[model samples]
Target: MFDISGREWIEEEYLRLHEQGLVQEKDVVKVIGVHNQMCERCLNQSDEWFGTFTYKEQLITYCRQCLDFKMVDNCHYLYRSLMPAKITDNAHVLNIDFKLSSLQQRASDFAKEILEANDLGLIWAVCDASV
Candidate 1:
């Protein structure tokens, strides 16, 4: 079972992406599923979400609440997690023929638009452009 808030976030992200012309309606369901799976895997892989952090180190592995409050402070991780492996694989295979820079720029623009429309406080630093 998926957390309600997590599920809602995934749906919202998918819709935002669609609205930005980054992804199509047909891809929404697949993207949402992948996002949910990735988030669940990330949570399971990190013990910090449920355990305590030592005070000696300022580094604290935040819980789900903390992470949510941070609004996915790391956009690179979020982008990588949200992007389908197949797209990356295809890009690699077509590297010689495709304009990687142009594609990345478009993706960046799309991401920025989505973030702006949603009023997402965190910027996607990994993007080529800022919203």
Candidate 2:
């Protein structure tokens, strides 16, 4: 189950992955709730790794051994991922010379025209449907 779920501090995150067909369902029951988390700063800090905390009127869980780092609260969300394709690790180029698709080219041309005019530019699209 650990092999399938990978390593996540939250159990429901793995279950959520299973529901999304990202992980095997058989591994869900075998997954145990993670009651401890290594400090993001120092994993081998101490046995008293995790402790409950409070900040901004919200209760949170944090790494006690490292001055309370890597905190998570009620509003926090966790995502456990399966094996995913690796894209470019560091591709932070602002602009590149590449052949764009027709639709993308249209958007690019529109953006160029707007920028050339030096007016308030607005080019909106469904950036992400999931969110």
Candidate 3:
């Protein structure tokens, strides 16, 4: 039986983690359950172990086996990866063993040719499409 205050505190921490790239965006989505009123990943196996979080005067169910996910009754749930992004020791090097696919290589080659030729229209890569 958790209180609403505890939920708010945890959510604030989650938001902070999201800002620091330790979690997904602060907006976690609820995956509607189909059959079981349990965590989609863990699917509570009647272990009789769990935690509760109060949301709007209702207790949101959380599984003990898997904590990163939560369920609201059997129909709704919110999920976020608890695992944080990996940080390499060398910030300059991203991946040591990385291979590009044939199609990707061709596209890269085409872009390189265009850049080398000083083309007026250069293909731009959009990394973050937050809008």
Measured by lDDT, the strongest candidate is 2
Enumerate residue pairs that collide in model 1. none
Task: Go through the candidates in order and give each one's C-alpha lDDT.
Answer: 0.40, 0.49, 0.48
- Each candidate structure's TM-score, on Cα atoms with residue i matched to residue i, is 0.26, 0.28, 0.27
lDDT: worst 10-residue window of model 2 = 26-35
Task: Give me the runs in candidate 2 sitting further than 4 Å from their true place.
Answer: 1-9, 25-37, 40-49, 52-85, 96-131
Model 1 is weakest, by summed lDDT over 10 consecutive residues, at 72-81
Can you write out model 1's per-residue Cα lDDT over 1-131, one digit (the tens) per residue? 21122222344464566577765544323321223223322443344343334555543332353354333321112322233434343443333564557656676577678756984333334544433
lDDT of 3 at 74: 40
Give the Å shift of residue 16 in candidate 1: 1.7
Superposed Cα RMSD, model 2: 13.6
User: What TM-score would you give candidate 3 relative to the actual structure?
Assistant: 0.27
lDDT of 2: 0.49
Query: Compared with the true structure, what per-residue lDDT tens digits does model 2 show for residues 1-131?
Result: 33443444344555566677756644333322223444333343355655665678875665554333344333343333444334455632357676666776777789878867986554655553222
